[model samples]
Target chain A: MDISAVNALPYEDFVNIFGNVVEKCPLVSAAVWTRRPFVSLADLEAAINQFIDALPESGKEGILRCHPDLAGRDLHRGALTRESRQEQAGAGLDALRSDEASRVSRLNEEYKRRFGFPFVVCARAHDKASILRELSERCGNERAAERARGIQEVKKICRLRLQDLVRSDNKL
Target chain B: MDISAVNALPYEDFVNIFGNVVEKCPLVSAAVWTRRPFVSLADLEAAINQFIDALPESGKEGILRCHPDLAGRDLHRGALTRESRQEQAGAGLDALRSDEASRVSRLNEEYKRRFGFPFVVCARAHDKASILRELSERCGNERAAERARGIQEVKKICRLRLQDLVRSDNKL
Candidate 1:
């Protein structure tokens, strides 16, 4: 789809296509729809990034909390959202050996316990080994820094999702 | 768990146990944790209800949108959150015949197109037959009334989930 196709969507259509761009937070897309008629795909993305960046601490935490734990229950049970399933599989999370899975699970819990939100990374950007490494390192970060890091990862995930839906190379 | 147990919980534990009481909106639990030390289970529930009740229209719609459509893709894919999976099973949504499933999918799409959110009902409280009936009827409701109705059903689902977690009759 091109920017014109995106710009032409009704509110519901816009939301249906873009709602889960920010993980499970459709409210982001709903809010973004109000600022429509994007000059380019980048403008639309900036709108989303601005909305996320403008959120208060609790709101950002809420967005993070909405995310499923990496290689956790949902993935094991075949219950991941379509985007999440693909991303996790892309990172080889779906094929983790039992030992690796257990280690990831433990680190995920420890991360959440420390940060009050799951350790979120753009899974498609890293394999299981790298994900585990980052999860371990980030667990030691200050809460404020970790929170900032997680939100930035969310935006990375969003940019990829947006690219999947809209042809970024197409001129407005 | 009793009210005393609930009040005694650390914030992370509290959220872990009650975070999903409102379906996918852990933010409710996260926010409610700040107002802790409940006098009783009822008081905790009231805290949750009031937080939901106080949301602006967009917030309410976002909450509804978080819910999966009855007998929809998540159910078919075995991807529902555990709470949702059980509630849907209790309502016989898992056993829908092909025709019933198709009807539901069509109605769900139509409903979303019309209302900007999915059709939400407290599945544990209704069998598939009654759910279809309600879905058919509510499809015609004015947007404001339907939004209010969906939120109320969310509360009903919350109440049941709370009952599952904290015994309603146990004295504080």
Candidate 2:
């Protein structure tokens, strides 16, 4: 298939393919679609930026839905690989001695009580201490800001994920 | 776990935990570790950039191992969801009439011939036509460059998967 052929696709077909992606992971779809008819890679990136900026305040929760629970040991239909689970949990609970583990447990309880959800961060980029610090700091963020931030973080994660998917397919 | 606790752990433990992640997906671990001791969200992103820049010549091959093989159906431990497979195959070959079906088969064959592997793309992000176009254009790329790009994309995918895992845990 050539770019010309892709460009020639009826908008409905194009939308249908992309719409499924958007529905599954709206942020990623938004990032990709924000740049329509991708003339070049740079243009594609710009569209991604524009999409991120244009996301509605109400849409944040939808974006957040794409992420799985932290320390969620069980596998779901479309969960992360086993390797990913170990990595996030390892980093999340990194250096807890017995006492610190209790404290972390307590904090987890209290934070959940306050926010109505487990603390979420883009764990891939954070170390143990940094994550804890974020946990503490975000505990104080008004619910709205924290939720918005979570959505933003999720979007970043989606972009990264989509990029990886494309790369893997190309290799195949 | 506190930062000190993470630091206090035996180096082997750190390696053991983080090692699984890297082992499952080296590009992802590299993407995460490149940003060690992430103090701020900004720091974490900076590390991701560094990882992208420092990717090795062979990194693409390393990432390819993370993707499941492409078949008329799914077969790997973790690949597309069941629903995704159903959607990808369409109602059946009969639904495609003859020409459309032949075109898909031919494109799949050409893609495999040029890349020495199945035409892989995050089907979620593309329609049949766009995917076909990508297949043709990417076939033109030198193996080395294509391989590098593929690995980079895998890194992105792994990170997104990890995020999903963490979010799911938090929800629980």
Q: Kindly report which residue stretches of model 1 are placed more than 4 angstroms away from their true locations once superposed.
A: A1-172, B168-172
What is candidate 1's CAPRI-style docking category based on DockQ?
Answer: incorrect
Candidate 2 lDDT for residue A97 = 61
User: For candidate 1, what is the DockQ?
Assistant: 0.17
Q: Give native contacts recovered, as a fraction, per prediction.
A: 0.13, 0.00
Model 2 lDDT, residue B116, Cα: 38
Candidates 1 onward: DockQ, in order: 0.17, 0.03
lDDT digits (tens) for residues B1-172 of candidate 2: 4334433433223332332222132223322532346564344444444543453332233234323333332332334544334435442422454566566667656654554334445544556566556766776777667666665554454344434433443322
